[model samples]
Target: MHSIHSTDAESAQNLTRYLADEEETLKFGKKLAACLHSGLIIHLFGNLGAGKTTLTRGILHGLGYSHIVKSPTYNLVEIYKISGLYLYHFDFYRFNDYSEWEEAGFRDYFNSDSICLVEWPEKAGNLLPKADLQCFLNMFDSGRNIEIRSSTETGKQCLIHWNTEKNI
Candidate 1:
């Protein structure tokens, strides 16, 4: 993995990196996991087969989850309890309308005691709450380019923590 850019502003912070392969992506995810906290909401943007699930798997692994981690495409969401934190992984790729989000009763999942990570969040429209952090993955000829941005103060703190922890 290569650091492309990193910037810190008053309200928003951005970090960009290049993942040369699947292993690097997972490693990056693991690094990100170390900086996660409860009540955080993250939006993941990527195309199909963009290694989103793989990255989440690495996060789970970093958080001491030993079982399988799969994309919640059909199930919409998967709940995992790791180190006393409730991590909700949601995929709205199959969503056709905003009502589906309301009907699923997922609003309650984004609480102060839990962390929410959503994929295909755009499909749900404005039903979901604003994400603290947004991660975008774009595919290139040899690998993937990941850009992580913090849209909230809490997210900025996490990014700052990640920057500090990653250097060591």
Candidate 2:
């Protein structure tokens, strides 16, 4: 038997959009949030102050969370259980060691029927799970430039549904 390593090129397909302001970013998140499903891991790639938390807030708002949405920088992870869905918002910016992720007993959170949105995933090293979607956001002169990439079959299907709704 031959073992092969192949990348999911189909999942590599990406969608790019421009947000002219914070509202647009929130709108985009609202639209994107509806596309997400259970057991999906979304990786947020951006530097500090790049609006990761702001986008997450929009996603939470779209998911029917009426309370305040804040970054879990100090808390490491914020647990949001609403409308029969469990959303784990994790921030690993403060992580100094890879083993710290394992030590934190966070692995159990990635089970089925849960959605994980991770910021600063790189800080977790290989301890993190493979992302179904990778969302990259960059600050721009007007607002932010955002790119979304699907990296799993489930993610691709989700994007298809998002496209059907957004006419993208």
Candidate 3:
């Protein structure tokens, strides 16, 4: 894997990392969990087998969730409550129509009391709330490259916190 680096100049807006393998990705997610807070919406973009679920597992594990973490593809969404915080892991891959989002009554899920991590958000066709942070994961050779961008003040603060807390 390529060397991982964070650009301080734009640290408040974005952060990039190259994970050598699944383990690195999980570790990175764990570290990233420290920067998370309630009410942040994170949109994850990646193709199949791109380690999106693996990264989410790491983040959940870092947040002290001990149960098995799996993709919400079949279930559409999974709810986890940890330390008084509500975490909603959503997978919109099965969405055949944007109306399905509203029909499912998921609009209330994106509130100040919860943190929503959405996969295949494009499938929802802009019906979902605006993401505070957007994460892009791409496969590269035998590793993965990830870029996290902040789109709002809340996301910017998270990125800044990540910069201060990141070890790599």
Candidate 4:
């Protein structure tokens, strides 16, 4: 329902947006999807029922995916290929220890040609790769309050695109 943007540095920034409903959340996610590129690591922060998966579904929709976009809660990871982009959606909610991540060998998937979207990364401690963009979501009376922080130049570029798109 509202957007507030600010820059932290030349190549780092933060933005907060209020999503009044699921439709708005999806729309925002689509915009984010357009800014995604390979080799980007994105960490999503939110509680259960906080709309993380819905936003992920929206991103997949924006990327031209028509099939089901289900959370990888059970599978641990879901792979999607679209227009030469390899997206790896990961959920570490089930992780009981940092060793679980190392044992699973999930780091191998975060390669040059892969764009990783990780949820519940806190469960993995520092074992997970650093995120280019960090997204935090909280529940709001109307819907969700979300914040996107750019930690790398690559992430800043995406936020810049997202800001510009919102203005337009």
State the displacement of the C-alpha of residue 113, model 3, in Å, after optimal TM-score superposition: 0.8
User: What residue pairs are clashing in model 4?
Assistant: none
The lDDT of each candidate is 0.87, 0.85, 0.90, 0.86
Backbone clashes under 3 angstroms, per model: 0, 0, 0, 0
RMSD in Å for all candidates: 1.9, 6.6, 1.9, 1.9
Provide the global lDDT of candidate 1 against the true structure.
Answer: 0.87
Q: Highest lDDT among the candidates is held by which one? A: 3
lDDT of 4 by residue, 1-168 (tens): 445434335323787788888898888788788888889999999999898888898888888888998999999999999989999999999999989989998879999898899999999999888899999989977689988888888888888887677532
Clashing pairs in 1: none
Identify the runs in model 1 with alpha carbons over 4 angstroms from their true place.
1-12
By TM-score: ranked, best first: 3, 1, 4, 2
Worst 10 residues of 4 by lDDT: 3-12
Model 1, span 39-121: residue lDDT tens: 99999999998888888888888888999998899999999999799999999999988899999999999999998999999
TM-scores of all predicted structures = 0.93, 0.91, 0.93, 0.92
Better of 2 and 3 by lDDT: 3
- Residue-wise C-alpha lDDT for candidate 2, range 1-168, written one tens digit per residue: 111214434323566777878898888788788988789999999989888988898888888888999899999999999889999999999999998899999999998899999999999998899998899999977788888888888878777777668535
